[model samples]
Target: MAIRMHAALRRCTWLLALGWLTSLPATAALPEDPFRSPMWEYNLARYLGADAAVRHSDTVVIKTPPFAEDATQVPLTVDLSAFPHEIKEVITWVDLNPVPHLFTLRPEAAEIRTVALNFRIQQASTVRAAVRDEQGGWHVGSVHVEAAGGGCTAPSATASNPDWADSFGQVRGALFSPVGGVTGTRLKVQVMHPMDSGMVGNIPRFNIETLELRQTANQQRLASMALSESASENPLFVFDLEHDAQQSGILLLLRDNGGNLIESRMGI
Candidate 1:
């Protein structure tokens, strides 16, 4: 079994390297496919460091209006109905955001067939909401965020990031306010972060780290492995859950490459 595992690991590594070649367009000047499908990029393997694949779906709707005036506060929403069963996680990503992964939520108490939340858009580009079902299949929906900026590179509200050392959630001893009636509390948990991609060098030579949401009460995780660059800056994760009067829950998040951990408890 060890030998087979090693061989499989080597094969995966080889294929991952080839993914870069496959992503390049036939032309050097126009390397980026204007209509490139996010599902085809081997992102799960290349970025998230996992071998995740997605299945496209029209049922999934990535809600972003054609125009947004404020780059700092833009509303983004996602809705998928009668979605496939293979789905285990749902995520909304900005193709142009410095990091892309804005926020992702797992079905804490429900499958979360729909979501709605306000997000900061950094620029105009194709955004996507990708879902990984229980069966290990992926479903995705993309949208366009008009010209906006200031989100991807914003500094932390306070000085240095708290010494939570990867801890995530509300401020110390903060109470959780559960929302939603129809679908129970439509909870939207967010991690405070810049989600800085090392590629970003505003002045030059300075690099920002990647941020991500890592875990939840739900058995299935969002998009793929714990969150990563697939999200946007200061990721605001919107999701739904069943109202179990007898249940208490917490949202576990990892920051900067999914290493640090934090917990946000749900309020009654």
Candidate 2:
């Protein structure tokens, strides 16, 4: 009887353990690709790393034209206003472009709700914006754009102009009142550069490598971004910053791969 009771007790303990395991929530499987691109897996591993925890998220919205009229100047807007979690970093890329990586933005002392810029597309490609949350999970948003091709290889308009060097590294920026119900300042900045992709004949790749926005008073960095050759020439960047005071003043600093630095002040 003692042996039988001991055996019964062991069986009951095993059953309890199994029940507890079954009651716990199941781990979520990765979602299916919405764009169905062949390079999805490869690009994901290449840019976001092989072991990144990724999922398709509606909160991370990528707004761009379905058909790109000019592949060299296709506008892209990444909106993270609806994302519930705190963002650590944002990376944008074109899957089929010769230089696939576009830009990586790390919000240091600012709240970046939206980021807009123009980029070059080699062909009809899938564009992706991957936002990394505080928990290290990457939420991805993707869109497809149809193009006629040759955007990356084509010579920039700035390259053909003889006087381009005269205005090179010039920065023009303005701070406007917030629009579209957003409660922050809208900063639009245009930088003059050839932004050569080196794909064009005899034009070596020259582009802005790093950009920083800071408080003019204390030089406190608000945000910083790293750009690549995939960006368009004379890049126009739009950032929605949480800082709205015109008196606080904002400083723009840009650096190129050739060791050129441009600095300007706005909202003074």
Candidate 3:
């Protein structure tokens, strides 16, 4: 009689556990890729990790020319103004380039609304921008660009110039009041570099590895970025910073893999 009573208790516990599991909510499925490129799955797992919680979001906007007039200097813009959550980080990459990784931007003391840069593409490819929110979810935006071949393997225009080294590491920047009645400051900066991808014969990979924007008065870093070889020869970067009177004066600092440092200042 005691043995029979123990078996009945065990059966009751098993049924209760099953019921609890069935009552739990099911996880939502990830959204399908709009572009549906073959490289989508591979690049997603490779760059964002296989276990990342990623979903396609309309709030993360990626803008680029449908047909690239200049493959080596294609312009790309990522706008995050419509994101409902606080952004933690932003990453951009080209799907089919030899060196696919483009840049990673982390906002420190600044609220980055929009970022724009020029990059090279080896061929027609899909470009992606993934924004990570405070809750550790990745919101992705993608756009397809058509281009001719040889953007990566071609020799840089700066490298062919006889006086390329004369203006190396030079920086020019300007600050403007917010445009379109927006409540922020607009910063445009250009850095002179060969940005060699080493794909061409005898050209070693030489490009800016790190860049930082800081407050000129206290040297407090507002934002930082890590760049890769896929960037254009002389990169033009545009940033939209949230309005802050205390952040009137800005400093730009850039360092390359060749141990070269460039610094410049711009005042609002």
Locate the minimum summed-lDDT window of 10 residues in model 1. 203-212
- Could you arrange the candidates by lDDT from highest to lowest? 2, 3, 1
By TM-score, the better pick of 1 and 3 is: 3
Runs in model 1 lying further than 4 Å from the true structure? 1-55, 84-86, 102-110, 115-122, 148-150, 154-183, 189-225, 229-235, 243-261
- Write model 2 residue lDDT over 14-44, tens digit each, in one string: 9999999999866545557888888898898
TM-score of each: 0.54, 0.87, 0.87
Error of 3 at 166 (Å): 1.0
* Whole-model lDDT per candidate: 0.53, 0.90, 0.89
**Model 3, residue 25: what's the lDDT?**
71
RMSD of 2: 6.1
Candidate 1 lands at a TM-score of: 0.54
Cα displacement (Å) at residue 219, model 2: 0.7
lDDT of 3 by residue, 58-156 (tens): 999999999888888999999998989888899999999998899999999889999999999999999999999998889999999999968989899
Look at candidate 1 and tell me the lDDT of residue 172: 36
